[model samples]
Target: MAGTDHSVAPIARGPSIVLVEPQLGENIGMVARAMANFGLADLRLVNPRDGWPSDKARAAASRADHVIDAVRLFDTVEAAVADLTYVLATTARPRDSFKPVRGPDEAGQELRSRIEAGQAGGILFGRERFGLSNEEVGLADEIVTFPVDPAFASLNIAQAVLLMSYEWMKSGRGENSRPRFVAPEVAPASKDDLHRLFHHLEDTLDEVGYFYPPEKREVMVANLRTMLTKAGFAEPEVRTLRGVLKSIDRALGEHRS
Candidate 1:
């Protein structure tokens, strides 16, 4: 797990991720990547098939070193979540248990509320093939499910982590909440900063002949800029991006010369 940020204003913590009898090291690694993407750190594994200290998993993490380094191993799901006050068990199939079934959004909000009130909580993900057993689901405070295509409702373990982690990270962004610090080198992106970045990228793309097929240029440019804008790059992020563009442009010019 990544170390907590100890800035003047402490950061809010996301729940521990407990993987029950996960079969693949690659999947576990990708799960770590997803969790890190959404500001989650803690990871507890219950009897991983490949066992711990898996270099394959770490390599798949793609520099999510903190999460890979701090991965916790556990004997069972019951023991894994024993310290959590509220545990949400994830399942694809409906069960006979009458526990509240929450969509990711509601569960995230509730987890935030619980954490704010000093309760520790975590989410449980089951094995890739079978998913959480009935006994495992029974131990949770509630259940979480995705509204997916009924005929093909399967989700990869990493996809599940990304969705749930997104909701968890999204929950703490209310008006009253202090914004989480982005990186030590930069702050949250402003609208104007994003606008400049949009132009910078589009200009570079045009120069590089990326806007091919003259008729498709406008729509293609719009799509490209829109996707980059959604990333919400910070000040340093914008600068670094422009630097990348300059580097690429220079490289291209050298090749032409």
Candidate 2:
């Protein structure tokens, strides 16, 4: 085992924390404290209610004043992340939308990898009141979700930010090790990549006349897309699916002969 730093672990490439339309000053200050605790330096505030350079926020920040001082104000979430290549939105409820849902640990790994790969990355934390609008969330490249009791999943904004920061810091230090789980990096397929595969599958289905009754095609295709999307296919797994499609095509050709 390697010796790990028990102190606030700094990520080799830290992610910018963006608070979009946040409501409370105290929460902002606490978020700064949390970010500083885990060595996340960049903070962007979009349309804050209590305004910036707040004394209450500074007081809550305590020794984390550096984070507060480094905070940048933006008019919009898109403006805040205009230069970022990878953007992740933190949310509590899972939606039936088309996007990848990553736990904080996985999100941290992805963030670090992107940063190391010379990509600008950021994560959006929505307003304390309503959370991010579906439109606001649509701007993100991925979604980072925390695992909480299904019965009660509402987490304080600062708490959510802190938890993610903790996981990210731990991930950077290689502390998020589980003995039984498979490492996703070995030919792992990202959710976005997997989405492409699902689309391809549906397209192939159309070509082979799998869908009938033009009126029912939409519903059937949607159901099929959802089924495969939730199965969590990897890169190799998607490749295998393509292989299966190819084999089916060959058999169909032989039968036609």
Candidate 3:
């Protein structure tokens, strides 16, 4: 709700989110909110219980109007996904049918691959109370299930949508798979820079008589070098550390004088 950036364009095409006989308008709105969060906009409703154009849904969406504005209404599950090339049904229980069952991550990758190949795809969500009947599950090509505790595995429609949406985004390739923001770029310290740091630090330690027993000095310095190398410090970090060592060296010199 808080991160919706109106300036950024929403993803016009991905997988169709087909909700079969959704009971509440708020849940519909929440579903839209989830879709928008992950750049999904196509929302298809198969006989929403409280009817369409719901103000409650709009309020619940928290300004994800792009998804709500282009909502498509269908009379049946078959009709809703009729145009799509592939469909995955969300269910918690095992079905008697022979459809290939996939977890959310695999389902997301499959959907992303299909969509990238210019195929239409969709996911079916059933009624909030009982979920998809076997008849409804039969409509989808594959079955996607969440790995939840068996004692209480039922998930809210919005939560189910969110999980799939997140996976869908993650399954993308290159820049599409990455999150909107990342850490600032910093140049890595070169091997020369690191070698310089190692010598500087070792020199300071030698001046301070830190390495006792001349035979163990080599092993101690090697261990210190190994520890510092593992950090993979950036150029700025290396410079800062060098400055710290210089300060210590100056302090030592003043004390000796």
Candidate 4:
């Protein structure tokens, strides 16, 4: 929540995050924080242990108030997912039931497709200690299981939510799933600009006797050219290198004089 920008609107559309018997208010708050990160709102809690509107949750959320403020509480899993057309239950353990199991990425793509087709979707997260009951998982259309070490498969409620939320955002955004900021765009140095740089550098090196065994100068120059070409310098970078070479050449000339 360090980069929380209130000026930009939060994503209100995605899937509903339904927590089944989540014990801690802090966990609930963290779930809200995860939801806010990927633009998913509409948190539904089914029988939270300590009760709702917790101060601890708010503190843990790190100022993701939009998600916490709009939480919807329910008495049962059945009631919690009543309005959702498609539901995905997240569980680390494999069940005896034969519901189609999907990885996080596949589940995310499916949710994005379903949501785009005008269907409401929800992802169910079980409790901290013991996850959702077989009956609770029965309500979901598909089951999503994370790939983790079998010995330590269990994940924190917030971590699980964050993983799914990230996948959901990636599936929806396609190639656009990237950070908000990017390096400034500068024009690439043209071949002509690179050639000029090569000449200037080679001329300065000749003055400095950098290339030994005069016969190997051609190969050395070719190697230098290859190395510089691989850098793919921008126009500004090329100009800077040329200026540096000019300064060095002038300095060497003055020393010789």
| Model 4 misplaced regions, further than 4 Å | 175-257
Total clashes for model 2? 0
Q: Rate the local accuracy (lDDT) of all candidates.
A: 0.80, 0.77, 0.85, 0.84
lDDT of 3: 0.85
| Candidate 1 Cα outliers beyond 4 Å, as residue runs | 1-12, 176-257
Residue by residue across 1-257, what tens digits does model 2's lDDT show?
Answer: 24434465444458889999888888899999898778788989999998877888888876577788889999987678766767788998876567788999899888877776566778999888778876566667778888889898889889988987887677667454546964444344444554556567777788788888878886686566555644545468878887887787678788889
* Candidate No. with top lDDT: 3
Off by over 4 Å in 2: 1-13, 175-257
Kindly list the per-residue Cα lDDT of model 4 for residues 65-146, writing each as its tens digit: 9899999999988678766667799999887565688999999998997687666788999999999987677656678999
Predicted candidate 4: what Cα RMSD to the true structure?
A: 23.9
Selected candidate, larger TM-score, 2 vs 4 = 4
* Cα RMSD to the true fold for all candidates: 21.5, 9.2, 22.8, 23.9
The residue-by-residue lDDT of candidate 1 on 88-112, one tens digit each, is: 8999998866677899999999888
Pitting candidate 1 against candidate 3, the one with the higher lDDT is: 3
TM-score computed on alpha carbons, candidate 2: 0.65
- Tens digit per residue, CA lDDT, model 3, 116-148: 766678899989999998756765668899999
Clashing pairs for model 3 are none
Clashes of each: 1, 0, 0, 0
* Span of 10 residues, lowest total lDDT, candidate 2: 182-191
